[model samples]
Target: MKKIKYFYNTNTLRYEKLVTPLRVRLLRVFGFVSALLVSSALVIWVYTRFVPRPTDKVMEYRYNSMKENYATLKSEVKTLQDQIAQLEKRDNEVYRSIFEANPVPDSMRVKLIEKKKELDKVEALNDDQLSNEIANSLNNIAARISYQRTSYDGIEKLINNQEAKLSSIPAIQPLSNKDLTRIASGFGMRIHPIYGIPKMHNGLDFTAPQGTPIYATGDGTVTTAGVGNGTGNHVIINHGYGYETVYMHMVRIKVRDGQHVKRGEVIGWVGSTGASTGPHCHYEVHINGSPVDPVYFFYNDLNAEQYDRLLKLAATGSAKSFD
Candidate 1:
C-alpha cells in the first residue's frame, strides 16, 4: 500500500507531493477493465478448445442412438407391409373363392397405395426418422384394417347371397332317410322294368312301402299336381332360379297346384301307381330344365366321405327304375 504515485503538480513548490490527475486516473481504470475482460475471454476460449464437455457428447450420443432406432423401425414397417399384403391375398383366395365373389377392385387397392405414398412423403419431411417410421407403421396398420373391414363387409353380402342360393337349390332327401330303404335306380341309361328296353331314367328312385310320406326337397310352389301317363300321382315344384323338382308314383298328393311347400314338408305318399312296378318316389332335380344326377345335390346333408360312398354306390348300381 506504500508504493507512491508520481504525478507532479505544476503550481506546487520544489520537492512537493504529487497528486494524480482525474483524467489519468480515469484512463487507468478503463485500461484495467479492458485487460480483465480480455483475460477472461482468453481463458474461456482455451477451456472450450482443449477440454471435452458432457453436453456435446450427450447430444452426439443421442443423435447416433436415434439413427440406430430408426433403422430398426424401418425394418419393422417393411415387415408390416408384407403382412398386410398376405392378408389381402388370403381374403381373395380363401374367402372370396368360397362365395364366387371378385376381389377388391384395382382402383381400391390403388387408392390405398397412393395413401401410403402420401404418408411416406410426410415421414420423409421429419428430421427424426424413428418417429417418422413409427408413424408410418401405425398408419399402415390402420389403413389395412379399414380396407379389410370393407372387404369383409362385401364378403358378408356375398355370403348372404350364397345362403339364399343354397336355400333355393335342392338340398334334402325328398323322402325321409329312415323310410328310404335304397336307391332303386339313378339317372342314366338302364333297362326299363316294364318296357324291357334301355331308356334314360332321368331321375332317382327311393323304394319305400306304400303310404310312406313323401317330402318336398326344397322351397317352391307346386306347378303341376296331376296324373301323368307314366308319372302316376305326381307333383312338380317350380323352385325359382332355374330349379324344379318332381315327385312321381305317389298314392296321394297333399299339395295342390300353386301351393307353396317348404323343404321336408309332406307333399305326397309313395305308392305303386301309374306304370310303377313297386311303391317308390321318382325324384328328379332339374336345373334350367336339364336333368342332373340327384345324388350329387345332397352334399348339404352328407360329408365328403359319405357323399363319396353314396356316389360310388350309385355308380355301381345296376337296378332299373320301378316307373
Candidate 2:
C-alpha cells in the first residue's frame, strides 16, 4: 500500500496534497549515502590502527629469531677468537721459547681490530652483510691456523738438528784417564823443557808410555793430521760450532787429513817427537781460535770425585811442559 503525506503550503494558503520534487528527493538520498560511507571508513581506520595483521605477526617473529641467532653466532665467534689468542700466547711463550725461535710476526696473524669493529655493530647489519662478515672472519682464522702449523713444522726441524749440535761439542778427554793420574802438565805459564825459559803452555800434557793410543775428543773432520813446528805429529779435529781439538806429540798418526771421526776414536799414539822431553800426549781445545783449558772438556768421561781429583792434579801439575 502507498501512503501520501500533505504539507501546509503558505503560498497556497491552504492544505493540499503535497508533491515532492525529484531534485529534493535525490538530494536527501545523496546525503544519507555519504554519511554511511563516512561512518564505515571511520570504523575501518580504528580496526587497522589497533590490530596486527597476519603478515606483521610473522615478520615480527622472524625478526626476533634472527636477533637470537645472530647473538649466538657472535658468541661463537668470540669463543674462537679467545682460543686463537691462547694459541698465539703459547706459541710465543712455550714452543718458541723452548726452541729459541722468534715468535710469528703480526702480519702472519689475523687482523682482528678491523673485523672486531664490524662485528661490534652486528645489530646494524642485514642478513647478507652479517653472513659476509662472518665468512671473512672464518677465513682469517683458517689462514692463521695454517701459519701456526707451519711454524710448528719449522720447530720440529730445529729439534732434530739440536741432536747433531750436541754431539758436535767437544766434551771428553783426549785419552783414557780412569786412574786420574795421567795429567803431566796443566795449561798455564810453565818452564819449557828445551828452552828452559818460562813459556805459555796452551794445552794439557798427559804422560804415557810410547805407542799409547790417543783418542779424538769429539765428532769432527780432521783438518790437519801432519807435523807441526813445535806440536810434532798432531791432529786438528774441526768440530763445528766454533770448537776445535788438537792432539800433539804423537808417535804414530793413525788418522789422515779430511777424515771424519767420532769421539773416543783412536787418532794417534803418545810420543815425545818435537820440542818435547818425555813421552806424552799434548791435548788442546780451541774455541774460535782461542785456546781454553783442556781440563774443562773431560766432564763426559770422569765422575765427581775423579774429576775433582783430576782438577786438583791439573792445577798443581808439573811446572815444566812436555812440549
Candidate that would win on lDDT:
2
The 0-to-1 C-alpha lDDT of every candidate, in the order given, reads: 0.82, 0.86
How high is each candidate's TM-score? Answer: 0.54, 0.63
Across 188-251, the per-residue lDDT of candidate 2 in tens digits comes to: 9999988899999999999889999999888899999999778899899999889999898898
For candidate 1, the lDDT comes to 0.82
- Model 1, 126-207: lDDT tens digits are 5665476566767778687778867877877877777776787888877766333467787899889999999998888888
Residue pairs in collision within model 2: none
Off by over 4 Å in 1: 1-158, 178-180
Q: Pick the candidate with the highest TM-score.
A: 2
Residue 213 of model 2, lDDT score: 91
